[model samples]
Target: MTIKSFSFSQLADMRIEGVGIHASYSIDIVIKDENSSSGKNVYISATGKSNAARAAGTGSLLFWCKVRDLLSNKIYSLERKKGEGFAVGFDDFVIGSIMFHIPYNSSSAPKIELEAGYLYDAGYAGTVIPFPRSLKRVIALTQFNRR
Candidate 1:
């Protein structure tokens, strides 16, 4: 089986009471078994940086997936909590990884897609001072262009 990989990066900036905050992050995805020709599978991974010390809190990471049910026209999802398979030390920059599984039945599987979201300094109180900062969330998808 051949492995394919992709990467993404995102940025979020918000202002509350004139306080500016920013966050930025990036992630990588690796497909360990793309040659199955049976179906499609996906994996999610990421890394981030914050201006505040210990901002990420043990470098926590969360992974989520959205799946659609063809028969019912409904969507389903799977998620993983922080500290599942990655680590975030005391450093200002933290890296993490999460894996997702999709089964392609060779005749009934659709392409796999992944999305990611992140919050920076969630618990910080908004003040009148402008902080000129940004927050970022990175998303990566594998098998995105494969049929």
Candidate 2:
């Protein structure tokens, strides 16, 4: 089991117009089986506090993954939110760990470099002025590559 989070204080010009959100998030990934050996069952989950301080009280939590050795380049993206079912375009997910069947090869566990972020939007004007400045924090969930 492992835990990771990214939090910033003293907003460096960070602001949202009507609805802004602040949160403390955590993630967990674990190997759930030791029998067959391809990719064991992996559980991932995130929880946090979100508040719309500036705009209307409307926003949603989101998650995405791009596993390439578990380390992904840092790129600030609004396209990701609209591109991948998020904000008004996406649906909701359960709070606990979501199970996944991870496959392994070469007698070693599979390693995935994941880069992700969370946001609080004003429904329509996402990452736009009048909306709070969005932040894309790099989350490096390490130690999955070893053992």
lDDT assessment of candidate 1: 0.38
Model 2 over residues 11-31: C-alpha lDDT tens digits? 222254453333323222222
Tell me the TM-score of model 1: 0.44
lDDT of candidate 1 at residue 121, scale 0 to 100: 31
Off by over 4 Å in 1: 16-21, 37-110, 121-147
RMSD of each: 7.2, 7.8
* TM-score of each model, in listed order: 0.44, 0.39
Against the correct fold, how does model 2 do in TM-score?
0.39
Tens digit of lDDT per residue, candidate 1, span 49-86? 33322332322324333433332233444444443434
- The 10-residue segment of model 2 with minimum total lDDT is 70-79
